[model samples]
Target: MDGVSPKFVLPETFDGVKMEITGQLGMIWELVKGPVIVPLLQLAVYICLLMSLMLLCERVYMGIVIVLVKLFWKKPEKRYKFEPIHDDEELGSSNFPVVLVQIPMFNEREVYKLSIGAASGLSWPSDRLVIQVLDDSTDPTVKQMVEMECQRWASKGINITYQIRENRVGYKAGALKEGLKRSYVKHCEYVVIFDADFQPEPDFLRRSIPFLVHNPNIALVQARWRFVNSDECLLTRMQEMSLDYHFTVEQEVGSSTHAFFGFNGTAGIWRIAAINEAGGWKDRTTVEDMDLAVRASLRGWKFLYLGDLQVKSELPSTFRAFRFQQHRWSCGPANLFRKMVMEIIRNKKVRFWKKVYVIYSFFFLGSGQGAKGNTKGLKKFPRIFKLPDRLNTLELGFAAFLFVCGCYDYAHGKNNYFIYLFLQTMSFFISGLGWIGTYVPS
Candidate 1:
């Protein structure tokens, strides 16, 4: 015993101990599985089913609201005070509110001319309109091309300024923020923003500016996007479908009912006062447009969606580009939600329902829509391959129907209170799962 413990145990004793330990561990596992594992699995299943049901209900409710919206939604001119601006006889185009157009681009070799041309051609008084081309292109050749395009437009009697920053600090948001810091931007009462790919109509300004001018309460006038190459490929087609739903159903409904909707990054006009009051732009999240919109909404500002005022734009035709776009679209809002949920909850300026709509409907549903396309819901099943496809189609149809229904609901409520609850716990989970799946690299 003094030499070390002469052998601690006999082989037979060790074997007995091992057997007893194994039995105890097995019993513990069984108990754990029965009470803990099984219930967790069941809870997961229930959550999935509940989410499916909630999304389905949301689709239905949106369908009904949008349908009614299309049939009877009044034109903006009818709802808001609007009047065509005319030049003063002596001053001649000097009385029009100075408007600033911002085009933010980064190495956009292909669409630079188109966007610049479209903005230059806006039917505002030449003396009153100023266009800012925020070029963040890293490629020297592309930068040269974009700057040349701006010069070409400038030579045509258009008041255009080509702007470049030392670095892309905040990506698009940073460029936009810098663009506003220019001394000339202060003289402009209203600002219109277009991405490099957007080609607004000639009358885009005439159509959009009046809403901001006539209504002091309105912060933004967001226009619908029309993709010229929607039929280019399957990917673009899917994008078109989703974007159409976003513009038609989601944007329209939010504008009609709540006077709120996320400010799409492009093809929109903003009241400079509202932007200033909303603390300008913060580059905290990738979805800077949505971030600004939420901040503006919380400050008691309203947005107007112009469904008929369509602006031509292009969708990402490649899978790689689409994945990146979807990732930003999905993740930015979730991050923004996490960042601003408390700010939204504590704001005393907005009503209870509006806060819910922003948190539940705008943030959740908007983020969910981006992830919904890339989800593989029933990949585990081989027989019912068409189920997810059918559900997607049904959802799109519901969105289409709801675009029409939002028109109806706007004109007539018709027991559509349920629409308020369409997006709830289920949407939050879908958004989270979708965000995780799309961008988490393999």
Candidate 2:
């Protein structure tokens, strides 16, 4: 006591003493994670369960649809051919109006060269083709690179114009709208939109232009997206199979049957008048492409899904990139549900079955949530083992039956039928994930 000499003492009610005590308690609570932890866990579990059920239902529905579609759908054997436009002189002589090719980009430096090269290589008359580079890049390097590319192409007398906005008002959709405001775009009778990543085949215009010329009411033509680097990795391979199934079978069948076919964002040509009448591209959702298509359909503007016309684009090479793309797509569908679903259902112009298909397709966006659910539910309820096991058994049985039938058809010298059946079976499951993954992100 003599050595301590009345050590300094602070009252519990003093500000410094109170603050020190409270800080220590806060640290202890932080380590413990407090009462909200249990509630957050509960909410998460509920979300997982709901998503799982939705995904399960979607997959089951897709499985059934694949079977029905295959059984009833028949490919049109008689090919409808269009006269080929062989040379620059022929293209120039053709009475078809000027076509505006708008290529929109945002930080796509890696793929920009290939895309621009593809555009320049398009088999269309240089005089009639107007190429608008809608670049929205804050990065000086990307801008400089694109500007130089544009200049190089311009020197070759490829009617190319480069434009960039001061700010991206609504991302891609805004950039496209701004591009349309240019006077050069106003002179065009049709517009062909391509993403920065796509490399369209040289004959794309030759093949697609004829369709618009033949059909007066046709608003847009969506060419199938084929992955140029599907075999790059496991993810890319899976994506390739998925796209093959989608473009080759599902979209073909859907369009042939006059069902609701969503407009793919790229590799498509649009009639300028139809787009104007349908109110151009709306930026209400991230997927301006689909939104525009649906609105155009609702307005009685027809769309053509050209199965034979292929536009190659790079699939996301990594899981993270793929996941981001999927998330954007999923959220877009949800947003579309709020924006267009009710109006579509109410519209007298759209057929009843088309509205139903729109609902079905919208549900397709929720499929990733289903994958998330399946992964979680399998972990949570071990009894759910029966679900996947049952599905596997059913899938195996179906495949086996098809194999036997295919062999029988081959023995009967119905070789085409046999091959068709085999391809159908293979594509059915391969493409089925599009619907399943909508509800399950994983």
Candidate 3:
């Protein structure tokens, strides 16, 4: 006490006072928590239930929209269909309008040859078609392979150009824009794009270019993607189902309803005029394809999705790759959504429905799709003692039927169940630390 400062020394009664206060607070907490804890839990559960209901209603509305679309949605009629080997006399010359085929590649050694070769083999008039391979591969060996492949195609009398940049400044999108700068590309009226892995059919140019040539207002002709390795594994199969829905129901609905749908980047043709008008490809967001499409749409350009024309491609074989792909897919769209929503709303050219559709889609289907739902304590149930197989099937079927009447999804498929299982397996909670401060009751 003699060595201690007056402020540092405690009163003789401090210990007793502290003990009494602590005990009193502990007793109060116990009493409050007993009465409060259960109701708080019940409140959380109720909130979860409400969110689930909202999600279910949203799904039903989507289902209803899809059904309505299927009942009566028609794509535009082709004024003139393109033939691979044959000539179109009405298109002026045998070669007709020049087309620039751009293949953007980056460390795609495994699939570059297939894409380049396919692009070369595309049955357009030899002189009229110009194939551009935009290789941004850091791997010198891969870059050489791509160049050699281009040379091989060129030697065979195919009009192909191999392009490289000192730096991948804009990555894939930058490479594409650089490819368009060549002197030969100036004559090209329309541009067709394929990702490095996409193995488009020989008739790709013929099938996609007709719409562009026939309709001056049409800015892009997007083709559906077909996964060649869809049967390789469960992951690919699930992706296949999901993509099938996207191409068929979602795009179909978008086209029919005149709501906004976007380019898949690869396997789509863009008019050079439209590209120029829309400010070319800006790498402001990860999704340059969709960004370009939206801008073009806002500029009074129409996009046509050809459902009948399918371009085969590979799906991500590994989960790590798939997760990265998901990140890009989710984050890019959301980024673009954030960047473009206000612009879209303010744009007088964009239809009201289209704006709403884009907003809702970016809000609900962005990264939020991966956020698992309100199963709560249901995950603790024994996995081994599941419902009987037959009963499970019957119950699922009944649920599906009931949902169909109200409009929603029931887990009838094995993959659907697997997804639920995956979600359960991955669930955990982290307590967020916050400051405990005094507050007045509102």
**How close to the true structure is residue 194 of candidate 3, measured as C-alpha lDDT?**
92
TM-score for all models, in order of appearance: 0.78, 0.68, 0.72
Find the 10 residues in a row with the least total lDDT in model 2. 373-382
Error of 3 at 17 (Å): 16
In candidate 3, what are the lDDT values of residues 224-333, reduced to their tens digit? 99999887776677778878988987676666666678888889999999999999988998789878988898898887777889999998755435545765666677
lDDT comparing candidate 2 with the true structure: 0.74
Global lDDT scores for all candidate models: 0.80, 0.74, 0.74
Output the lDDT of residue 411, model 1. 68
Residue 189 error for model 2, in Å? Answer: 1.6
Please list the residue runs of candidate 2 whose C-alpha ends up more than 4 Å from where it truly belongs after superposition. 1-94, 364-442
Better of 2 and 3 by TM-score: 3
Candidate 2 lands at a TM-score of 0.68
| RMSD (Å) of each candidate, 1 decimal | 12.1, 15.5, 13.1
Error of 1 at 345 (Å): 0.9
- Cα shift from native, residue 15, model 3 (Å): 13
Backbone clash count for every predicted candidate, in the order shown:
20, 18, 0
Error of 3 at 358 (Å): 1.9
